[model samples]
Target: MNLLVTGGAGFIGSHFVRAVLADRLPGLEGASVTVLDKMAYAGNFANLGPVAESKRLDFVPADASDAPVVGAALRGHDAVVHFAAAGVTGIEVLLEAAHRLDIARFVHVSTGDVYGSIDSGAWTERSPLTPTTPAAAARAGADLMALAYHCTHGLPVVVTRGSDNYGPYQHPGRTIPRLVTALLDGRAAPLSGDGGRVRDWLHVDDHCHGIALALLEGRPGEIYHVAGTVELTERDLTGLILAELDLTWDHVTATPGHKTGDHRRALDDDKIRRELGWRPRIEFSSGLATTIAWYRANPTWWRALQSE
Candidate 1:
């Protein structure tokens, strides 16, 4: 199979690409992969270094929103896996171009944030989208548009909503990497509000594995949730990072947060498990320790990122 993968140089996208090339993802072995990345702030070519020279991999440095470029690239591919931030850019152009170009399958990756925060139980795929932040709202809009295309134009599109992902290659702006990098740099990590906000964290490998399942087995116009196995409060998560670094709370600074909704976020992923037999494998403690080790050992990779 030939696949066109958007944001292939970003954290999760790169993980998927490498997995496919290594034949780690079931049902996609020996697939030829074409990567479309804009080399944006978060997208790094270095992320694909391990498989850069693989005969099955092709890298295209361009924006997915560029219609002419994307439309041309979609011509002969069997499917398109879009892992870019579609809410902010490119989902519309890619979906329209996929329709015009006759691509067979399109996987539109979204985030659990679209469901916003829920104070009680986990949100199922059937949960109503009531995103609070502007970013989440934009992602919600993109999800609706993708489903609409499936309904109106017979496009074979499947959407996957995942929780907070952390692993190697993640940009330092996120909570895990931000705190890890700050503590490494002998600086205090900032925790906004009261540090009570809670979020479910999914490892990137698990997220990509679930997405590969969605790509292979998902029904058209359906939505899948790749929920995290563990949920942690902001303060607790920060404490994990600090503990890993052997630092104390003095290394953390309290700051104002921009949250405007409920303090907790969770997702129920039983649908994907029952329908596709997908479940997360990595435990948070070991996964987080490994992640911290990656940052420590790859100082050159992240130090340059920090300087930028």
Candidate 2:
């Protein structure tokens, strides 16, 4: 199958592309991929370097908001797995283009952050979106637009809301990579507002795998929650990173009054697990260790990004 992936050069998107090329994702073996990315600050070509020579992979450095470019890119592709966070305008552009082309499947990769903070229990697919941050709000808007295309135009859209993802190739701007890189650089990692915020950390590999399953088997106009193996508070997660790097609390500095948005996030992924048989494979301890090792070994990869 031929697939067009927007934001394919970014962290999660690039991981999906590499997995497809490597045949790591089941049901996607031998599939060709066309990556459309604007190469923003978070988007890195080096993320795709591992599979750069694959004849099955094609790269397009263009904004997803460009209707002409997006419309042209949609041609001759069986499906589109959109991972770009280009907000409502980009999503509309892609949906319109996909509608014209009559694409087979449209997997709109979303985030659990759209559900905002949950004091207790987990959020089901039926949960109402209550995004507090601008980023999550934008994603929620894009998600509604995608579903509208499916309901109004029969565009066959599937939305997958994944938890926080951490693994190799993630930009340091994110929590895990940011703290790991900072600690690795022998600097104090900033802890926000007592570090009490909660997040479910899903490995990028597992997150991409869930996306693949949703793409192949998920029902049209449906939303699936791809949950992580564990939910951890910022303090607990920071402690793990420190222990892994043989650092101490002395290396972590608390930054008060800097916290914003949801203080806790969780998801009930029973729908995806029961319907698609998707579960996270990587454990938190091991996953965190390997992630730190990746940053340590490849300073050039992240150092350059941090310098920019």
Best by TM-score: 2
| Best of the candidates, lDDT | 2
For residues 200-266, what per-residue lDDT tens digits would candidate 2 score against the true structure?
Answer: 8899999999999999999999999999998898999999999998888999988774445688889
lDDT against the true structure, per candidate, is 0.91, 0.93
lDDT string for model 1 (18-105, tens) is 9999999989999999999998888999999999999999988889889889988888898999988756457989999999888889
Indicate the residue-level lDDT of 18 in model 1. Answer: 90
Q: What is the TM-score of each candidate against the true structure?
A: 0.96, 0.98
User: After aligning candidate 1 to the native by TM-score, how far in Å is the CA of 132 from where it should be?
Assistant: 1.4
Candidate 1 regions exceeding 4 Å error are 259-262
